[model samples]
Target chain A: MDLDFTPGEDTFRAEARAWLAAHVPATALPSLETAEGFAAHRDWERELSGARWSVVSWPEEYGGRGASILRWLVFEEEYYAANAPGRVSQNGINLLAPTLFEHGTDEQRARILPAMASGATIWAQAWSEPEAGSDLASLRSTATRADGGWLLNGQKTWSSRAAFADRAFGLFRSDPAADRPHRGLTYLMFALDAPGVTVRPIGRLDGKPAFAELFLDDVFVPDEDIIGAPGQGWRVAMSTAGNERGLTLRSPGRFLAAADRLTALWRERADPHDTALRDRVADAVIGARAYRLFTFTNASRLAEGGDIGAESSLNKVFWSELDIRLHETALDLLGSDGELADGDDGGGWAEGYVFSLAGPIYAGTNEIQRDIIAERLLGLPKGRR
Target chain B: MRFLLDAEQTAFVRTLDQLLAAADTPAVVRAWSAGDHGPGRALWERLAGTGVFALAVPEEYDGLGPLPVELAAAFVELGRHAVPGPLAETIAVCALLRGLGDRGPAKEWLPRIASGEVLVTLAPAGSYALDADAADAVFHVVADGLALATGHGPVRASLDPARRLARPTGGEPLMSGPAVRDAVREAADWASFATAAQSLGTGLALVEQTVAYVKQRTQFGTAIGGFQAVKHQLANALLGLEFARPLLYGAAVALAGGSPGAGRDIAAAKVACGEAAYAAARTALQLHGAIGYTAEYDLSLWIGKATALRTAWGTPAECRARVLAG
Candidate 1:
């Protein structure tokens, strides 16, 4: 199996690289260090969308070029290569669009797809409840049938990006009497501006309000706002989870880009005698390269229209672990300098390390992913519920 | 970018798996542990007849051109059967000889190796202490001297008794100097990749065996596999195998493609696979619950081999250091 892109693809890569070089101005988006900084980062998303370069994998109807997955991978490589600003509407573009494509009705898609594509709207996930963290099906959020729709009344804690989101998609228990807890759930969407909805920012240990606590008190959602058939929230959630594996998370090329930066950072200050630091840097590079190969293998499979099963779990685990390790190594290489915050008159290594801490916790925590691997991939006996 | 084996390779793996399964049973493993390496010799010959050993050797040396992935796949099968032989060493040595611009040694050894007539083991110094006891001739690096051993002799070792270890005395120097150093380093990288492939196979086999045993062996009125602790251990073993497999393939691909990062990647693969295989075997033994520790069972043999092989070319720490040393 060939790992190198075809000549045409390589030429395409060059063109993309040149275009990004010429058009995209280098802008450092706000580090997730402050609320105001993050809010300012939203403009970066609009700029990228205006260039038709926001999310390259979406179909042409969604403002993407309808490129193949491999090309999308190439675009990712170039995007990170240019050190482009992080997309503020990442949740909307990466998560909700894929969900809408798979489960949204035609009218629903027509309304949400363009706004999501153009960065006119931002979305947040309202999935986990106070009682349900890893055990997501145990969520206590309830939606009662109202006049023309459902009224959502519950709390969703650790709702990432909810404080500034325009809308949110949540899993609510629609039928309390259903046989299975999972069977009673329904996926519903509602505007954050709806009456009786309150979003309170939750400050993390890193002092960033990138996450929020959403309190829904009789917030009305139109019947059309329901994503799929009733009692299909679990299925809809699975599609969203699958998208997280495929497009929402850091692509393999993105890992390579991070590796290159880490390598350069290490080399600039590396002491030739410090063999241990050198070794860590080398591992970071190697890990990044292996990750790229794994991703490209997946991309090639997708290009051939092959179904990727539990193997994507393996990828998620690898990349998340690698990202954490690489950033940790970066901190170690910086020594005391690594502990300095972004504005602490030292390098950005410390801030980067702090950010890396969230890798394992986000996107269905690595522990749950391990459980998936154990049960689904290895066919091990199920754990006690 | 492709992750699948070609049809012929797939079929070949199937046949190899069957042969290994039938011939390398626990009884055979026990017998071999008593120092009989002859039981699997015929199967080795059959595999050689299929040109498994000739995969990485060039056509000019009476061998197949470089097929690192195919070679890796073959080693995986060997691991599945827990086959006891110097298959990896033979391929590694042949590749090294070919790299030295001396087709003479490779030409002399290829047909015999392919036909399983003469078994050639790798004797690179510093990586694994060469056992002069089992050597017809030893190839080694010495500071201003050459060494070789002609016959069997006494050597001290911890595991894998079927493969003895001994120190070689003086012999003729095959190649040396800066150019040979470069070639030797390149060969060592390939050797690391091959060992990693073998480790991946062994690790996978250990997981499969442990999972099967835990599912059947009852304890406390139920299968012990039903326990979360047992399940997590097996799951961790599976994780180790999954993580290492891709690194092995990536290293092989980089080496085959002559990429700039091949050396670092190979070292990483070696370190990862070494740790993975050791953990897998250790967990397998722990889960097998005393049966694995008995000399009559093959699990101990496989564990011993994994422990020995992981330390052979280089320790995981050493490989990790190499990768980090850039």
Candidate 2:
């Protein structure tokens, strides 16, 4: 089997490399969880969209280059190699955009995608509630029939991006009396600043407002904002979950970049006799490379028209674990200085370490992902969820 | 870029699997372990007819390839079946001979190896080759000083009875130069790569068997596989194997492409697949409880091989150290 990139892909890589080298900011932006950083990152998104670099795999009408997955991979490697800013619009562009393309109407795509791409309207996910987490189907959020659409009423905790986002999308109980918990639900989008809506920021482990509790009371949403048919919310949302767990949400480029930095960090300041830590660093590098190759294999499979299923759980578990190991190794190499929340000595690692902690918890917890792998991918007996 | 076996290779695998499946592999393994080489040797020749051994020899040696990808696929099936003999050693010896450019030995053994007429084993970086008595030729591997063993030592016991280890007591100098060093390194990489593939296959087989066993073997009035505890363990095993797979294929690709980093990549795969297979075996034995522990049970065959594979070509620590150095 051939594993080398094609000439066209190589050319795409060159062009992306050139653009990123020229445009990437000289210094890192403040944490995206903070308001000032949020605005700054949104501006970065605009800059990327201006050049159609924000969503390379999307159609041109949606401010993308319509690049193939392999080319997108090339662009990702270039983007991370250039140390580009984290995508502030990841939720919309990576998560919501895919679903919009798959299940949303053409009108919805035209109305929502361009804005999402340009960061004119940042989107949050409002799926989990206080009671529903691994068991997401048990969410209590409800949508009642309104004069022209639906009025949402419920609390969505740990809603990513909701603290400062302009709009949000999630599942709501459209037919509460349905026989099954997953049935008769509706996926809808609504303005976050609507009359009866409220967003209460919640500080993450690193003390940043990365997530929020979204409270919707009579939050009116237009009929056009609904995605797919009423009872199809579970199916539609599950599709997005796959995207979140798979390559789009956590591309190998980020880990590759982190790996490179870890290697450089080891070379720069690590003790010569710390063979154990050195091995750890090497392992992180190997793990990152393995994930990168595995992703390209998946991209090839997808390009060849293969369907994605529970296999994303494998990707989710691996990268989430890799993220933690990488940051931890970098921290260990920095010794006590690594513990600093911020500074040039070991700056960004503490934040990275804290962020990696969320990997196993979000986009479905690792526990849940493992269960999926066993029952679905491994063809294990149907286990009690 | 395609990261999968092409149509011809896929068909090759299908044919090999059918031949292997129809053969009573367990009986052959048992017979070989009992020092009856008749069935195992016959099976080997049939496998050679499918060009399994030919993949190791150079094209000029009346063989098809040094095709790493196809070799990786073929060896995985062999491991899945838990075939007995010095398989990886034989392939590594071919690589060694090809590198030797020793006209006498190359002409004498390469064609024979490709035809499955003789089994040549190499003990490079090690003191002994498994099944040395059964092998037609055994080479004592030394950097810049390669030699053919004049005679074999008494058979030594191992943790697994199936692995019959013996050292070479005397040697006939075959080659002595710097090319031998390079050849030794390349052959070691091939051995590691093939062993890694074997470990991956054995682990996969163990996991698949465990899953089937758990599905039917009930506890608490329900199938044990339905338990989350069992499911989670099996899931972790699957994850280890699944992720290890890409590394194996990537290592194969690197070897085939002649990448300078091929040694380091193969070492990484050796660590991953070896550990994955070892972990799968542990989980299988634990999950199967008493049945897995019994030698009479077929599970012991794979379980024993999985354990040996962890330290066969290189231990995890050594592999990880290589990774660090790289």
Per-residue C-alpha lDDT of model 2 across residues B1-326, encoded as one tens digit per residue: 98877789889888988899899788898888888889989999999999999999888889888999999999889988888888889888888888875667788889999999997787864587788888888888754678888888888877666788888867766788888888887788889999999999999999999999999998889999988889999999998888888899999999898898889889989999999999999999999999999999999989999999889888887898887675
Give the number of the best model, judged by lDDT: 2
Instruction: Residues A1-385, candidate 1: write the lDDT tens digits.
Output: 5566778779878887987888665555567435675566666666666777776777777777777778878888898878766666777777778888889988998889878877678888888888998789988889899998999998998888887778888799998898887888999999988998999988776777778899999999889999898788999988888778654477777778878888888778778778777777777776776677667667767767886777767767777888888888887777777777766344455666666677778778877776677677777666563
Shift in Å, residue B5, candidate 1: 2.6
* Fnat for every candidate: 0.41, 0.82
Best by DockQ: 2
Q: Which portions of model 2 show Cα errors greater than 4 Å? A: none
For model 1, what is the error of residue A150's alpha carbon versus the real structure, in angstroms, after optimal superposition?
2.1
Residue-pair clashes per prediction, in order, are 7, 0
Reference-based lDDT, residue A14, model 2: 91
Q: Highest TM-score among the candidates is held by which one?
A: 2
lDDT of 2 at A210: 95
DockQ of candidate 2 compared with the true complex: 0.76
- Candidate DockQ values, in order, are 0.46, 0.76
